[model samples]
Target chain A: MIPIDYYIIVSILLFSIGSAIVFTRRNILYVLMGIELIFNAANINLVAFGQLDPYLNGQLFSMLIITVAAAESVVALAIVIVLFKKLNTIDLNEITQLKEK
Target chain B: MKLIEIVFFFFAIQLLSSALVILFTRNVVYAAIALMSTLLGVAALFVVAGSDLLAVVQLVVYVGGVLILLLFGVLYTYRDPESYFEKKHVLLSIVTVVCIAGALLFLLSDLPFNYPQLETSPHDATGITKRTGYLWITNNLLVFEVVAVFLLVVLVGAGWIASHVLDKSKKDV
Candidate 1:
């Protein structure tokens, strides 16, 4: 059996990588992918802890998270589509509707 | 030391490497494909951790639904196959990530999981699938129903937002 620390360390590393992706990448798509990585990291944590619980609240929360993430990705992609349609680019920095004239 | 540990390490490596691919790859589609493998690796980890239902959900919802939607976005939004970041925050992000990860690892070093079902099926062990259904109907009925309604609303809203009507009106204005 693997120790819980393995799960913890792995998730932590993933969370960090996801954050790095979000910070470093200008492409909104990459940002979305990073967000997903972060979500999966949390899911791993929840499932790992769920195994120890008889009631399995952690697992239930993980299910909820998966549902929420799916919805979020849909909405975010739709927004990206619209943004591309209107602005013709997906780079976060190049989007400047709110920038001062 | 054990078979499960080896399996766990293998998947951990797979997940991280593929995720790194997403970070490093310039092509949006390659990044998307990497995301798929990273997710599959996560699902494998879920199975290794013993939540079969979650593994299936992760596969079906993430890889099937979100990945497809993302690829469609890619199709619609494909300008050049390649775009590069103008200002590289790579060093800053790396430093920040290292600090954050080191802090988390430090905190985790002391924390321990007292209850371990990792080695054996428990005395009152019931199938997670069965318990999930029961919990939905019994304890978490409100949450389940609300999430259903939320999902419907979010999808409908996204469709409306992306539809031609909004596009037409904005063009007219």
Candidate 2:
């Protein structure tokens, strides 16, 4: 079996790249995808560490994480839909009404 | 040189490359497809780690549910696709990512985590799925209930947020 350390590296890489996606992307939809990437990165870490335990707590935690992530995305997409309708645009750059003048 | 090692390497490579695609792609359609690849790779890795149940959950929820919803959302908000990525910060973001990954790798390498190197993962263990279900009901029951309610609230809340507001606005117009 591969050492648990390798999984950590992969998780870290996924995490940093996911952050890059969130940081650099302007589209609300692409940002959501990046958030999903970040979520999966953590899930990978949990599943990897779950191997050390007999009860599989890590897998259980990851299951909950996945469930919440799905629900979160549903609400986010709903907001995106409404935002598109109201503003006629979904670009994060252009929707800056919240910015102070 | 073992099959397990080969498959592990495949998961690692596919995950990293597809994630990079999500980072760099300017086209939203290609980025969405690439996210699908990344999610599939994560599911495979879950199987390799001996959790077939979570692997399947990852598939049904992420690839089937989330990706499709994203595609539908994209269809609704269709525009001439623009730079999801910031062209100006390309080099800066790359440098930041490299720094963060390097720092995390360095920090994580020192953590003591000792486990048996099982030649065959417990992937084929009998009744693992059964055990998972039992444990959920027996031990993690609270999480099960809360998420159930959470999803219900989300369903109604999302409908109200997405639909009801639009109707009021349309009436006003």
Candidate 3:
């Protein structure tokens, strides 16, 4: 079996890539995808660390996180669709800022 | 050298590279598809970590549910493929990614690498599903139930928001 360090390093790399995607991408859907990547990275860490725990608390929490991420994506994407319909574009910079007339 | 080690590295490559593709690919559809492979690779990682249950859930929820939603969003929103993908601050993001990775490795290098070998057998003797179920109904029951309530709320809220939009558009007509 490989050391836990391998998993940890991969998780760190995934998290970094996710962060980069979040910051650099202008498409809101890609931004949502980046958020999912970040969530999965954290899930990997939880499972890897849970392997060290006899009770598997980390795994339980990982399950919780998975459920939450799924729900979050649903709501966020719904919002994205709504925004796209109203704004005509999903580019982060192109979307008009909120201001009252 | 070992089979498991080989599998782990294979998935690790799949996960990392697909993630890179997802970030760099200009085609929104290609990026969405790349995310599928990335999630599957992560599920394999869970198996390597000895959590079969998590692997299955990751596959189901991420690959099946979330990726589908993302692809649908792509289909529904973009009329012209040219305008579908937009990236900003490329060089800055690259520098930030490299800096973050390097700093993390530097931090890791300073820490002692030794870890105590687990006392138990390599695999969990107890079935994780059973244990997870027990925990779900007992200690984690509250949180688990709360999640259910949260899902219900989100479901109703999404429906409400959607119908509200339709009503407004109809009135505008």
State the weakest 10-residue window (summed lDDT) of model 2 chain B: B119-128
Ranking by DockQ: 2, 1, 3
Better of 1 and 3 by lDDT: 1
Which of the two, 2 or 3, has more lDDT?
A: 2
Per-residue lDDT over A34-54 for candidate 3, one digit per residue giving the tens place of the 0 to 100 score:
899999999998988788776
Task: For candidate 1, write residues B48-131 as lDDT tens digits.
Answer: 887888899999999999999888887778767445544356566678678878988888777764665456534125558888
Cα lDDT tens digits for candidate 2, B1-173: 88887999998999899999878777788888999999999999988887889999999999999999999997888777653445676786698689889998888778766677665546455725887899899898998998899999998999999889799878988
For model 3, what is the error of residue B100's alpha carbon versus the real structure, in angstroms, after optimal superposition? Answer: 1.5
Candidate scoring better on TM-score of 1 and 3? 3
Clashes of each: 0, 0, 0
lDDT of each: 0.85, 0.85, 0.84
RMSD of each: 2.5, 2.2, 2.1
Q: What lDDT does candidate 1 reach at residue B138?
A: 95
TM-score ranking of the models: 2, 3, 1
Q: Tell me how each candidate scores on DockQ against the true complex.
A: 0.68, 0.72, 0.65
